[model samples]
Target: MLNVALFDKTAKEWREENKDLKGNMRDYASLNELLVLANMESFNAILIEKGLEQKERMIELRKLARNQMLSLEKLNKGNLKQLEDKKK
Candidate 1:
């Protein structure tokens, strides 16, 4: 479910698409993606303890993943720009 929320595909789907790959989709995930997955796992536990339904939890996790990824991308670009400016 978390995989679906973040990557829009399940492990089985990824496997089907990458037959020659050595590992799962997560093995190829970016640093930011790994971070978000960890965070989602934690959040999912809390949501489960709260008795939230699977559908509701999926929606919440998707929103969280999207927002966090967008913020990370913006921050990374800003840092990269700063580094380029410093090299000038």
Candidate 2:
């Protein structure tokens, strides 16, 4: 089960902290960028909770996090392309 609250809080915090870097929320690129940062922070917190002894798990988590970010980027690009096509 995914924790919606945790991700929402992380996303809000990221928005608050990076107000200067923020782009319009309606834009797919901007929205995806925010989500990626939020996910990274959430994953970092989970990694910290796992502690140092879980070396193998930590490595796996890092890879998972990277893949998740890349996936989000690809999805955002695809979504934007679709939107552009619709606008044509």
Candidate 3:
């Protein structure tokens, strides 16, 4: 479900699509993706404790994934630009 929210696919779906590949989709996830997955796991636990419905949790998780990914990407680009500027 978390995978569905973040990657828009389930572990089973990923495995079926990547039969030739080894390990699960997570094994092939980017650093940013893995970070978001961890955060989502924790957030999911909180949502579960709060008695939120699966649909509601999924909506919230997807929002978190999108926002966090964008923020991380921007931060990474900004840091890379800073490094390149320092080298110049």
Candidate 4:
């Protein structure tokens, strides 16, 4: 699961560790890299905190992504079932 809390915590740690840095560009870039890596590693489900300005939009996107995932899962299952039936 892609927990926002965990990301937040990790970002904070990175910020703290890089407090002497002059700009926030590096911090944000590092966070983006980490997120990309996590996604590539098969992380799913994002948990965000409440009161976010774009909460509704984020929720909608999440739902859409989840539905797509479900659809893909169903498709794979159907293909597997067909393969098994053919073998039998």
Most accurate candidate by TM-score: 1
Over 4-28, each residue of candidate 4 has an lDDT whose tens digit, in order, gives 3223345456667688886543345
Per-residue lDDT tens digits for candidate 1, residues 23-88, read 999999999999999999999999999999999999999999999999999999999999999999
Q: Give Cα-based local distance difference scores for all models.
A: 0.98, 0.56, 0.98, 0.49
For candidate 4, the lDDT comes to 0.49
Q: Residue 27 error for model 4, in Å? A: 21
Q: Model 1 — TM-score against the truth?
A: 0.98
Q: What range of 10 consecutive residues in model 1 has the weakest lDDT sum?
A: 19-28
Backbone clash total, candidate 1: 0
Q: Is candidate 2 or candidate 3 better by TM-score?
A: 3
Tens-place lDDT digits, model 2, residues 1-88: 1112223334455567568875533232455445655665677577667674455544554566467767877888999999999999
C-alpha RMSD for every candidate: 0.5, 8.5, 0.6, 10.9
Backbone clashes in model 4, listed as residue pairs? none
lDDT of 3 by residue, 1-88 (tens): 9999999999999999999999999999999999999999999999999999999999999999999999999999999999999999
Candidate 3 wrongly placed segments (more than 4 Å)? none
* Model 4: ten consecutive residues of lowest lDDT: 1-10
Better of 3 and 4 by lDDT: 3
